[model samples]
Target: MLEMKLTITAPDLSAAINNLAQTMSARVPGLQNGTSTCAEATNTTSVGADAVPAANPIQVTGVPTSAVPVAPAPTSVPVEQTAPVPTAAPAYTLEMIATAGTALIDAGKMKLLTDLIARYGISSITELDPSQYGAFATELRTLGAQI
Candidate 1:
């Protein structure tokens, strides 16, 4: 990054500043040495009566004082989502299966429930299909028989 060192308090510095102003005025036409070019930038040329006047007339270069319009929220979602329904055993659902498994887990046998789940080569209780829930529950209940 480029750096600039300017000491305004130094008595001899005023002459250097004057020389810079004179050079800018000579090279850049219409940009007067003393007048503020920052204030002159705010023009109501394109904007109408509703345009808000800036609180600060002078702004950082290349930045507009006007409010830019907000982008509207997305109108469409990427994926089409529908509720999962079991074709067979219409009365039972995935929620019921999850509840049953959670009951076993909550009864101080979380390891037993997870081990039974692993035996079926499934990672999560939610992965058990609605039709398979009855058999899965029966096998899980057999853990009590080991006692």
Candidate 2:
């Protein structure tokens, strides 16, 4: 139910019609010329019906009553595609954990460090599971140690 209007004015009617028709024909492929008698005289252009519905008609102003049937420009609908994002591997390493633990102990947090390792059911860094290195490093950072 949307209405759009475009106006093209020229000194000569035949020149305007011919110009518009030629432009349309060059831009659109597989277009068919309408049954307008003036089309034969001025060599009217053809337009395709693809992406354009025949139900909604175009009205051209400032032209003879036998104005060639006008069709709106073809349009394309874009399809959205989503791609899976790759997750980076954890950067935790045993050396990194050991360094952070040593730093914490040197900074007078020996009791806190021992308590943290016990909470993970480990008596020492060597006894801590490899898979738990990331969590362990995170806890070490919370204790003012850089890892």
Over the stretch 29-73, how does candidate 2's per-residue lDDT look in tens digits? 554443212222222222443233333233333333334468889
Return the top candidate by TM-score. Answer: 2
Clashing pairs in 1: none
Which regions of candidate 2 are displaced past 4 Å? Answer: 1-86
How far in Å is the alpha carbon of 74 misplaced in model 1? 81
The models' CA-based lDDT, in order, is 0.56, 0.68
Best by lDDT: 2
Candidate 1 has its poorest 10 consecutive residues by lDDT at: 59-68
Scored against the true structure, residue 27 in model 1 reaches a CA lDDT of: 62
Residues 1-147, candidate 1: write the lDDT tens digits.
433332223344445545555565566655544531333323332234444444334332322223234888979867978988868643545676667667776778889888888887889977776668667766755755221
Q: Model 2's lDDT to the true fold? A: 0.68
